[model samples]
Target: MAKLTTRGLRIDSGGTGGGPVTIAAEDVAGALGMGRLKPQAVLVGRATFCDDNRAQLELAKWVQQELHRRCRRNGWKTDYCEGLAQLCVFELVHPLRCVHCLGRGQLWLQVPERRGERIVLVERWRTCPRCKGSGRKRLTVRDRAAVAQIGKSQFADVWAERADAMLSDLYGLQDDVLRHLWKQFADEAA
Candidate 1:
């Protein structure tokens, strides 16, 4: 048997190379000073990057649920769930278009043209102020409010800010996962 100490309490791990040991949820709850811990779902199978991503999403979903439950005691707790949902959905469904340029990638500016004895306004093209040269930008509070429900519209500003940071992290995680998957596939092919 192997002994492990946690907070001055020693735990026995049966023996070395004992495969995997399963602990009761009640035991974990007792350790954490909780009344009880009941698992809602358990997913067991071959793990892959895709599975890892799914598990992470599931965890996020659970966190949102817990936040909502806690909102009964404190109203501010609900914002966390709303913010997380908005951030996740912003990338999945809401594609951004520069409001200033109207997705044209450029702005039409009116310039004064001197022609002989008369001055006339002529339309000139300039890069979009909102999105620079790219027609697309990240979803903004206004953009979200345009299509969001009355309830969702209230948290648009807050969600947009958090969504920006979350989106960048999500993109990086996706890129890493794709690279890993590609390398694994290439290795198997060779």
Candidate 2:
């Protein structure tokens, strides 16, 4: 599926076989039933200046009007419009997990079975019936040296750095529009 981050609204559609293509906000918004939301709304802040919310709304309204205009021009399937609108809302809603990992970072790891021939699998230790001596489980580690290597989240600072990097992208143009419009508007206006 094509996952488009349109103004922080992720709209997934029938992708082009390859990966999803990221297009301009207008294109994605239009595809996802944002015909009522204007590309102008997206571009206006980025391109021009409007201090008040009403100006931005006007721009968005203009964009929606344009989307509808294009629908008529292109003879698009307006029937799918509702579904696309739902996609718009879905995009705005906070995603539970990262689309990349689907929440879990590491893929399922298959533990290697111990065998008689392997040098590491000497008689001293047989298959770790629990982890199969793979040391896969964080708590279970037959290797004393390896066990010491595991590091905890030690400090909130370390965790904070990871939090900053690991979490889904927290902010975007549209996000600012919704939250910090004055700053964004000024930034864009400047």
lDDT of 1 by residue, 78-182 (tens): 545654544444443334667778766788899899999999999999888777855666655555544333245655544445445544544444334323333
Q: TM-score per candidate, in order?
A: 0.35, 0.24
lDDT of each: 0.44, 0.33
Backbone collision count in every prediction? 0, 3
Residue-level error in angstroms, candidate 2, position 143: 45
Q: What is the C-alpha RMSD of each candidate to the true structure, in Å?
A: 19.4, 20.8
Candidate 2 has an lDDT of 0.33
Q: What would the TM-score be for candidate 2 when compared with the true structure?
A: 0.24
Candidate 1 accuracy as lDDT: 0.44
Q: How high is the lDDT of residue 127 in model 2?
A: 39
Residues 32-121, model 2: lDDT tens digits: 222232343444433222223554445444444444564577675343333222222222232334333343333344546566765342
Question: Which candidate gets the maximum TM-score versus the true structure?
Answer: 1
Model 1: residues with Cα > 4 Å off, grouped in runs = 1-77, 93-137, 145-157
